[model samples]
Target: MFLAWNEMRRNKIKFGLIIGVLIMISYLLFLLSGLANGLMNMNREAIDIWKADAIVLNKDANQTVAQSSVNTDDINGKFDKSEGLKQTAVIATDGKLKENATVFGIDAKGFLMPKLEDGKLFKKNNEVVADHTLKTKGFKIGDELSLSNSDEKLKIVGFSESSKFNASPVLFTNDETISKLNPMFKGDKINALVVKDKNWKDAQLNKDLEVIEIEDFVTKLPGYQAQNLTLTFMIVFLFAISAMVIGIFLYIITLQKRNLFGVLKAQGLTNGFLAKSVMSQTIIIALIGTLIGFGLTVLTGAFLPEAVPIKFDYLTMSIYGIVLILVAILGSLFSVLSIRKVEPLKVIG
Candidate 1:
C-alpha cells in the first residue's frame, strides 16, 4: 500500500487522467440507470402507488391490465381482503394543450386510490383528481376538462404526485363516471382487481381468471420489459468494459514497475504485499470515481426538467456502487498476477 501510494504521488498526472476517464464512465452509467428507472416509473407509477400485493387479471387478457375484464362477482370471497376493482382507459383531451391521458376508474372510497397532494378525492361523478403533471398543461382545480370522444366535461378537483401510467398523466374517477364515458364498462365490470391476500396463489378461481404479483404485473406493461432489459444489458456491458479498462491500465502500470518489484523481492519483500498494494490502489481509485459519479447523478436529477422522467433511488445507487468496486477489484487481478511473476534474480543481475 505504501509503495502504491508513493508511485501514485510520483506520477500524479497519469493516475489523475485514469481517474478522470473512470469518472466519466461511471457518471454515464448512473445517469442511464436513473433515466431507465424514471421511464419505468412513468409506465407504472400509478400502479406502484396502489401498493397492492397482487393483481387479478382475466386469464385471456395475457396478464395485461388494460385487456382484463372482471366484475364484483369474480372477486367476491376470492381473497382475505380485496380492494374495489380498478380499470384504465386512454383518452385524448379536446384542446391542443393536453393530448393523451390515462383515466383510472377506481372506487372513490377504496384503498387503491392514492392520497391527494392538492385538494381531496372526487366527491361527485363529474369531479376528478389528476396527476400533478396536468398542472404543466394549464389545468387547475375547477377547470373543466373534456375528453376527445365524449361529450361529458370532467372538472379537475385534485392532483396527486407520481400518479402517471403509460407515459401519460393519470386522471382518477369513479366507476360510474367511467361507465358514462364508455358504455362498454357497464355496471360492476372492471379491468382488474387488486388483492391483499398471501394465499391468493392457492385460491381456486374461475379458469378464466389469473392472479399475479404486482412486480410481475409491472413488467407486463407494454414495452416496459423490453426497455428495462435493454438498459440493464447496457449497464452490465458498461461495467464489463470498465473492468477491462481498469485491468489493462493496471497491467500496463504493473509492467512499468516490474524492475522495481523484482528489486523489492530481491531485498526480501513478498509478492502478497505487492498484490495487496495493487488491489488497494484499484479500490481507492474506483471508490473516488464512483462517488463523484453518484454526486453528479444526483445534481443532474435535481435540475432535470419536469417533463423528463429521472428517478434516483438510493438502494439502486448503492448496489451499483458495490458492483463497480467489485469489478474494479476483479480488474486488478491481472496486475496481481504480473507482480507474482516478477523474477528477482534476473532483474538484480
Candidate 2:
C-alpha cells in the first residue's frame, strides 16, 4: 500500500490520465443505465401500474395486446373477474389544436382504471381520463376533444400519471367510446382481457386465446425488445472496453517499471508483495474515479430537459460501480503476472 501510494504521488499525471479515461467510461455507463431504464419505464409504465399477474389475448396475436381482439362471449366464464380492453389511436382536435393519443376503453369501475392524479374519474361514455403528459401538451379537465375518425366527440374529465402506452400519451375511455371511434370494434368485441385471476386453467379460456404473463406482455410492445437489446449491448461493450483499458494501462506501466521491480526483488521483495501494490493502485484509481463520474452524471441529469428522459436507479448504479472496481482489479492481474516474471539477477547483473 505504501509503495503504491508513493508511486501514485510521484506519477500523478500518468495515473491521472488512466483515471480520466475511467471517469469518462463511468460517465457513459451511468448515463446509458439511466437512459435504458427511462425508455423501459416509458414503454411499460401502464402495464406495471396495472399490477396484473397475466392477460389473455388471441393465439395468433403473438402476445401483442394491440393485435389481439377477444370477444366478450369467448371469455365469459374463463376468468372469475376480468376487465376487457379495446384500444385505438385517435387524433384529438380542438379547433387548430391537434394531439395524437392511444385510447384505452375500459370498464369505469375496473381495477385497470387508475385513480386520477388531477380530476375525477370519467362517469359517462363520452368523458375520458387522459395521461398527465397530455396536460403539458395543453389539455385540461373539462376540455372537449373531437376525434377525427368518428362523429362522436369526447371530453377529458381526469388525468393520471405514468399512463403512457408504447411511449405515446394514453386516454382512458370506455367501450362505447371505442365502438364509435373504431368502425371495426363492435360493442361485443375487445382487444384483450386483463385477467385478475391467477388460478386459471388451460381449458378454461377459449381455444383461440392464450395467456401471457405481464412481464412477457410488456416485451411484446412494438419495438420494445429490439431497442432494449440494442442499448443493453452497447452498455455491456462499454464495460468490456473499460476492463481492457485498465489492463492495457497497467501492462504498459508494468513494462516501464520492469527493472525497478527486479531491483526490489533483488532486495528480497516477494512477487505477492509487488502484486499487492499493483492491485491497490488499480482499486484506488477505479473507486475514486467512478464516484467522481457518478457525481458528474447526477449533476448533468439535473440540467437536462424533461424531453430527454433519464431515470437514475441508484441501486443499479451502485452495483455497476462495484463492478467497475472489480473489473479494474481483474485487469491488474496481467501486470501482477508480469511482475513475477522479472529476474532479480538480470537487472543487477
lDDT of each: 0.83, 0.87
lDDT of 1: 0.83
lDDT score, candidate 2, position 296: 94
Question: What residue runs in model 2 are displaced by over 4 Å at the alpha carbon?
Answer: 95-97
What lDDT tens digits, residue by residue, belong to model 2 across residues 1-349? 8999999999999999999999999999999999998888888878877888788899998887778888889888777677888889888976657988889988767888776889988888888998887887778888888888878888988898757888888899877777888876876788888877777545377689888878888988898998789989998898899999999999999999988998999889999999999999999999888999999999999998776767899999999889888888888889999998899788667
Task: Specify the highest-TM-score model's number.
Answer: 2
Clashing pairs in 1: none
Worst 10 residues of 1 by lDDT: 87-96
lDDT of 1 by residue, 4-89 (tens): 77888889988887788788888989988898898898888877777778988889998877777887786789898887655556
